[model samples]
Every structure is written in C-alpha cells, then in structure tokens.
Target chain A: MSESRLNVLKTYKLFVGGKFPRSESGRVYEVSDAKGNWLANAPLASRKDARDAVVAARKAFGGWSGATAYNRGQVLYRVAEMLEGRREQFVREVADAEGLSKSKAAAVVDSGIDRWVWYAGWTDKIGQIAGAANPVAGPYFNLSTTEPTGVVTVLAPQDSSFLGLISVLAPVIATGNTAVVVTSYEAPLPALSLAEVLATSDVPGGVVNVLSGKASEIAPHLAAHADVNAIDLTGADADLARELEVAAAENLKRVLRPAVTAEDWTAEPGTERLLAFLETKTVWHPIGV
Target chain B: MPQSIPQTVPAHGPDAAARLASMADVTASDAALRRFLHGLPGVDAVGLEGRAAMLGTRSIKTTAKAYAIDLAISMIDLTTLEGADTPGKVRALCAKGVSPDPTDRTTPRVAAICVYPDMVETAKAALAGSGVHVASVATAFPAGRAALPVKLADTADAVAAGADEIDMVIDRGAFLAGRYLSVFEEIKAVKQACAREDGSAAHLKVIFENGELSTYDNIRRASWLAMLAGADFIKTSTGKVAVNATPPGTLLMLEAVRDFRAATGVQVGVKPAGGIRTSKDAIKYLVMVNETLGEEWLTPEWFRFGASSLLNDLLMQRQKLSTGRYSGPDYVTVD
Candidate 1:
C-alpha cells in the first residue's frame, strides 16, 4: 500500500498583488535542501517582475495606508494566527531551508509567529511613541503625526530565511507602508510559504508583494525605481548595498543600510525598523483661528 | 458644403468623390441603409478576438519600445470631460498637452485636448499656437438624447469657439432600434455643423459608445455607418460608460477602418478611448494597428488614444527607458 502512494509536491510561485504568478520572464531556479537534495523550483524574478511589484505596491498604497491603525493591527494579528495554523509546514520548510533540526526549526517558526504578533501590537502604538504635539515659540498649536512612506522595497535576510524574513517584512507593512519583498535567494521556500499566510491573513493584496529570486538581480531595479518610496537593504551584501544606496539617491529614496555585523535573529527587536518607513508631517494651526 | 452633397464624399479629387458618391446608394433610403449595414460580412467573434489576443502577445522591447512609447505619446487625445471642469483645469490640461513631460523637452506633444462644448473657448485659447488642437464633444455628448437642432447648435457653438475638431456622439437609441438612416442623417448633419466660415470644417470624430451597442455585429455596423456618413474618425466610447474600450472592441473598429479604406479609399481614423492606462497596453494597441492597418495608420493623424491618465504612464515608461529605472507617479504631475 505504501509503494502504491506518491508524495504530492508544491509549486512555489511569486506572490505579487495578492495573487500567485510565475515570473513574467518564465524563469525558475532550482532550490535544494541543506544536504543538497532538490526541493522545489522557485520563480527567478526578472527586473520586469520587480517593476510589476512596484506597480502593485503603489496601487495598494492608498487603501492600505488609509486603513485605520486598529484595522491594520488586526490584519497583522491575523497573519500570526494563520502562521500558527501552518506551524508544522513552516517547521518542515525551515528545517529543509536552513539545515536545522526539526526541533530548532519549530522553535524558529514559533519565533517568526511571535514576531508577527509583536509587530501587530506596534501598529497603533508606534505613532503615539513617534509623533507629538510640537511646542512652538508662538501662539499656535503645532501637531506632528507620522505617515506611511508609500511603497517600500524589502530585501529579506539570506541566512535566516523564516525568522529574519518575517522580522524585516512585518514592520514595513505593520506601520502601513506597502512592500515589494525580494525573498532570500537560496532559501526562498519559507518566504514563498509565508506569502500564502499573508494572503489568507486579512492583509490586502499588493500590501505585501513577494518575489523569489536573486537579490542582486532584482534589488537594483527596485532601488532605482522612482515610484518606490523606500528600500531596506538588510539582505544585500556590502558591494550590492553600496550600489543600491547610490541608485536610491537618484529619487532621494529612504535607504535602510544593512548592518555591519551579522544580525542576531533571536534577539529582542527594536523600533528602528518600524520607524524606517514612516514620515513625519507637521501641521501648525493658529491659536484663535 | 451644401446639405444636398452627402458628407461621405471626401474633400479630395473628383475621382474619390465620384467613387464615394456611387456607393452612396447604400444610404439612399432606410431600407438601403438597413440592407447595406446588414449585408456586410458577419464578424467571426472567436476569430477576431483570437487574432487580437494573438497580436497582443508580441513582445515590444528596448529601442522598439522606446519608439512605440513616443509614437503612442503623440497619438493621445489628452481628454478632460468632467462636469466640474474649470477653466484652470482645462488650462492645466492644455499645458500638459503642449508639453506632456515638462521635465523632458524631447517628449512629443499629444495630438489634441478633448473637452466639452462649453469649455471649447478656454481650451482653444489655452492651446493656441501650441499646435495641439482643441476637440470639443458635441451632440449632447455622452448621452446624445437631445433633438437634432440642439445637437447641431452645440456643434456650431463649439466650432464658433474655435474648436479644431468636433467629437459628436451618435443617437445610440436610434441605432439600436434599427433606425440607421436617422443616425446616418444626424451624423451628416453634425458633419455640416463642423464647417467654419473660412471654408474649412473641423474634423469630425463620431463616438459609437460601443459598450451600449450590445453586440460585436452592431459595433461593426456602427463603424461602417459612421465611416460612410463622413466621420473623419470613429471613436470607441464616451468614457462615461461602465465599459468604455476593450481590446476586441478596438480590434473590430480597426478592422472596420482597414476594410473601409480598402473599399472606399477614404482612410478613416480609429480612436479607442477610455480604460487604457498603461504603456504596455498602449504598445499592444500599436502592435495591433501595425499588423492590421499597416505602418500608414501608425501616426497620430490616423490613430489616437482618447485618454487622460495614459499620458503619464507613457511618460513614466519613457523615463524608465532613458534612465533604466522605473519611474513613479510622484515624478509626474498629479493630474
């Protein structure tokens, strides 16, 4: 009876604008496990795919950014809930992707879910912490509030596929900005799987677009894209990051430089990533007007 | 210019006029118009759509894409027909029409600026000396529910206001009710209304509002009917309707112009207005035109995109081509 059964395989596709699509270039690269066993073929997105993702992210920007902070918080929490239900699948994928043992993979998956929940809580609170009623030296009530900085292009961390990817992605969107995330090159399976979670979660389509491909190939286009408002270079290496920073300057895009040291995925996170994609808009109202 | 002279006769050699006049028997009466319109070859919906979709798949890239983008830019009838349109808005739209991308001087200007009858003077004044024509929609515009006299007065008012082109809407209710001669007579009447005192008439673009016509067969019949009634251009829709322009609908119109030219040698223009927003879609239409009507109809004179937002997408794509980076809306004007 066991001999007659065949194992079902999954097709990994790029998630752009809330739908799963193969690369417009129709190219896919082979992905393997830690021991070099072939796992699946992930779409090797082209510059065109990166462009399409920017368009999708821009289209989703108005609705997603206009959503109530409380509603956004609920959506992020819903992503965590979806991840909790798919814990076993993530554990398996993370185990295969990072060459970790099942127990360690399960722990990492749990951490990723916790990360989503953590950011979900920050959605409504980040503004209160970051914004203020400015004290001006005049008879005026000046208010400063934070706004989402439009479409953001995110490069997911390479080594820590599941936890690190979620760490960078959750905050960009949780704060209201839409994202075009380029998943880690070698271990894209976990990120592609996470896209399914985001889709099923209440996250609106285009709010977080996921493309699985070489970061070096896709990041440059996105970094230089005039439409992309900001870019997180966390997944890029030294040389690529330098080039991308220069490209991002053409349109004066907000650039999040990669850390000099290897990031500790398990460490308690800070509010830096959440603040990276937000802008402060100051309004001054005359006292008696 | 007399009403007795059928407007179907092109303003050209006597040979061309004689040829078109000979074919005028088709519109001699209601029965003749009905038989002629019905007698045209029936559209193979599957085959037409298949060909259009097949042509749409042609990959235009790099230098070719650059050329197509520029060509498409020149073909746009930058339109603003909102009820709340102000003089300021029309002037801004006129400035945009003159220099689509103010940042890039090389960007070709659009063919015309389309507006309503009341705003014709503002648009004409704003577009003066820019080489961009002011096109005013007449004949009660999007609905076309008014009487023939009111429609003609509307057309005459726009013409007096210095409009270079008059985009008139056909009586769709009459057409749908199989009153082909009435629609044909109305179009002929509007064509006469387009005449100016200087012996020059504004080019007449007849809108079918193909969405309301209900069938591909009707669209084909409408296309022929407009072309035969002396429409300088046959436009797809008014852009107010829910379904303005679709690929297959545009393809059918293109085929109509192509066949009309072959049959009568009066190469009428085709304008697929509304709902086309991206450079990729614009390039697809260019590819369709190149394949269907050949290179001759590729210019702004023969084909046009009746759009407002399409210009920005074309400009963005042009910037992407020049800089090798994707351009965004922030870089373009908000309009």
Candidate 2:
C-alpha cells in the first residue's frame, strides 16, 4: 500500500439498512470534472437497490418518530459536528462534482453545515410554529401540531448536491420524517460521503436512506409507490414533473414539483420551503382550572 | 354491422414554436387587418380554467364566422356520452350550446349541436328550426385509438344524420409514441369522411384534448398539426383530466389560430371546455379572446364554449349588471 492510500481517508458506500454496501449490482459509474479528471465511482443503483432503500426507511420511521423532539435535536447536532470534521474533503469533492470554483464549493459546505445547525435548533420548535389551535366554536379544545408526513421520497437537486440534499433532509427529519432520497444526476459522490457521515452521526438506522441511480428510472418508482406517503420532485424535467404529478394523483399524494432553474445553492429560499413539507400535528395537554 | 376498417392517426414532428408563429398569420396579411383586429376587444374576461383565445377578424360578424363556431363548439365526443343514458343527454347538451336567452345583449350564441354519431339525428331534430348545426364526435371520441376506416364511417354516419360538422380525437397513444404524421393523416381521412356521403361534407374540428399533451409547447404543436391537416378548430380539453383550460394553454392556441389564418387564410375558432363553472371564469376567457385573436373573433359564431353550466352564469352576470338585483334560478331556463 502506498503512503497516499494509507493517509487517504476512506470513501463511503450506499446506505441501506444502516450499513454501507457497494451497490448490489456491483456497478459503479465514474463521474468526472470539467477537465475530465476522474473523481469517484458512484453507485449505479439498480431497481433492487431502490426497493431496499424504501424498506430501510420504512423500518426506521416508527422509533425515530416516537422519540421526544429534544432527543431528535441532539442527534441532528451530531450530524453537524461530524460534517464540521470533514469540511476540507467536502469542499474538494463538491467543487469538482458541481464544477464550481473552489471558493463556491467551500461556501456550499459551510452553508450545508449551517443548514444542519439551523434545523438542529428547530427539532423541538417547528411543531409549535407550524401547528395551529383551531377556533372550534362550540366543541372541545381543538389543537393541531405538525407531525412528520411520513416516509417521503425525495429527488434531490442535480447541482447543489450536498447542500440541497442536506437542506431537504434536515427540514424533513427535523419534524421527524424519514426519507428515501435519490441522489442528483452529476454529483452523487459527495452525497454518498454525507451518507457515511449520517451513518456515524448517531441518527438511528433508516432515518434517511440515499439511493444513487438514474432520476428517470428511480424517481418514477418512488412516485408511483403506494406505500410512500409523498414525493418531493425537486430535480426533474417538465415532462417528468407532469408525469409524476399525474401518477401521484392516482392516490392523491402530496407532490412537490421540481424547480426548473439553476441558482447558487447556499441562498435561502425562505422558511416556506421548510414549512411546506411538514404537516403540523399539534398535541396539547389540558390544564385543569 | 361494422361498415369500415379500423383507423389510426399518424403522429408527426412537433415544432410548437414554429407552428405557433405560422398559425398566428392565418387571418389577414395587411397592416390594416392587424390594426382592425387589435382595435376591437372582448366584452369580458374568460375565467375558464384555461381562458383561451381564437383567430380571425370579424370574429363575431361573418357568415363564415358562424360556420366555424358551429363547427368548433358543437362537438361532444363519446367520452362524454358513455354514461348509460347518454344519447338523449348528449342531444340536450348539444342543443344547449346553441340556445340563446331573450334578455341577452352582446351575448353570442353557440354555432352547432354536437353529439355522438349514435345521436346525431336526435340533435338534428332538436335543433331543426334553430338554424344551429349538428356535429358529432367520431373515431372513438376521447381516446382516438381506432383504425382509419372505422373512424371514417363514424364521421360519415354523423354527416348522414344531418351533421353540419364532424369533430374527431387524435390517437394520443400514437402521438406519445412519436407517430406524428400518422395522427395528421388520420385527421385528413376523417376530413375526407365528412365529404364521403352524397355531396354533403361536414366541417372537421379535431380535438387535441390539450390536457393530455400537458405543456403549452405540446399543445401548440398538436394545434398546428391538427390545423395543417384541415381541422376547423383545435379544442382545449375533454373535461377528463385534472388540468384543463389553463390560461397559458389558451394563450398559446390563440397565437396559433392567428398565425394559421395568416398562412392558410383558414380562420379558426378556439373552444375551451370542461370545468368552466362560474361567470368570473367566463369573463377571463373573453379577455383572452379579445387580447389574442382580437375583436372580430369575440362573437358567439366565431368563439364557442363546450360548456355545461357556463351559459347560465354568463346570463346571470349579464342580468346582474343590467339589473341591480341578482337573477333567480328561473332567469335562464334550461329545457
């Protein structure tokens, strides 16, 4: 073994069932930078891998959701801490993967970690802010708080791979939602590295499962899947967006249409984007007078 | 009992932007025509889910204009007629399009009576003295998945029943499969069917059912192909899909109708049907027509609504505006 290989930190694999496994197909598609330099081999996930990720997400949903919001907040902060340790590595991978300048990639990593920190603070509070007390005129005390919408299937954005992936997942799970997230078209490697960070970040198995494959192939399955409660299609073409909208209508699933735009990843799209995917399930204890 | 062969509509290359540009010029060439059309505006906005527009100056005043609306608005495909008690209901529905109110001012009338080939004669008798036309949806209605000869005969039957117009559905299955020219040829054959019996050939309006195609671009492409293949009108929806008569979709079709007139001098009408429930929706559609197709196409004879409940609201709103009080349910009676 060369000194470089020895000194080089390890790369991660696809996260399924809490363990990192090379794609079951044993197929890896190489992603390259603009200059054609090889970056890393990303998993060319098969349909089987997609299905496996779904199973893992379903399994982890109950316990993670049943936990107190305070406990969930600590786990989310752990992810931010682990991410802070890998800042330099992330900057290089994402910059090369996104073809952004080095400074932009570093900024994206910083924003991504910031995203984790921001949501970490929200785990215990989003429910209060989102859910409402209904003014039921004649009936009992009617209070509704936000609850996880359940196992959401997300098609992560193609450009802002790491930050976009983290932005979507952190908000979702901040309110206790589990996810089967599909990695982007060009930048799947950094997403897998984040999955490694997640595996060790004290988050329970299956809170978030990352799948790497063609958006066309994997996204349709998730959208049409009956078991999946909702789909966040934030990285698709117009045709794809319409198709998924139609398919989702078969069961009236909540659908988030893909944004047909490019932008700086770190910029805030505002709190609505975070508030949108969560269904506040407000619970209140009556005080006896 | 089947008289002809099964038919197919050949799909062709769809260049929506180019087609829209060409369809824009179908009305008149000179600057005078543009000035005249532009100067006249619609009476109200079309709040139809897809507030749509059409082509042709004198859109409201021509004998030719009525001919187009009779052909365009009076189509009811079997997709609507599949209800177990359809033929009679379809007849009533077709007649409703042409029915006018005594108190209406600047209120345009629908041109033709539309129905299934099975009920074309029924519509003919119901609208005999009304000067309204009889039209039928042939070639399998909403799906448009049959063979050529069968659709041709279906068109022939409706015409034989005194149909003044024949509207057919393109094989969306074929279009999605990249069979564009085939869809074009199928439309041509149906147009031919309109002329098959004795010397009486109905005007042909091909229903692209824009909802199925989805994008404004695809809608434009389909509208162009239908017009090029001799469609008298390109319609918005079958009232079947969730997304229908979107304002954006109508804006695109209006542009196409305008350009088609410039290219072919074949002025076309626009019909946005399905889910047009309120008076506010009707106004939005009128606005779209005024802005896109100009003043002439605003007449009932040139522009029509394949609507079930829109007429009542249009009347009610007109009544409210004319009289300070709200009109009662009996204000506009339906037979």
Measured by TM-score, the strongest candidate is: 1
Candidate 1 versus the native: TM-score? 0.96
Quality of model 1 by C-alpha lDDT:
0.92
Q: What is the TM-score of each candidate against the true structure?
A: 0.96, 0.44
Cα error of candidate 2 at position B5, Å: 64
lDDT of 2 by residue, A154-225 (tens): 888887788988877787787787888888867888888888899988999888888887888777767765
lDDT by residue for model 2 over B1-335, one digit each (tens)? 14452121111112322443444443233343234333333323343223442321123333443333333323222123444646667666544555545555344455665567888777777777867776677887767777888888787888777887777888888766656667766887887777744654576767778778855556766776777666766778766678767666777788888876765455677777677766455556666677877887777545666665655655654554454333434467563
Tell me, by lDDT, which candidate is best: 1
Residue B124, model 2: Cα distance from true site in angstroms: 66
Chain A TM-score for candidate 2 is 0.90
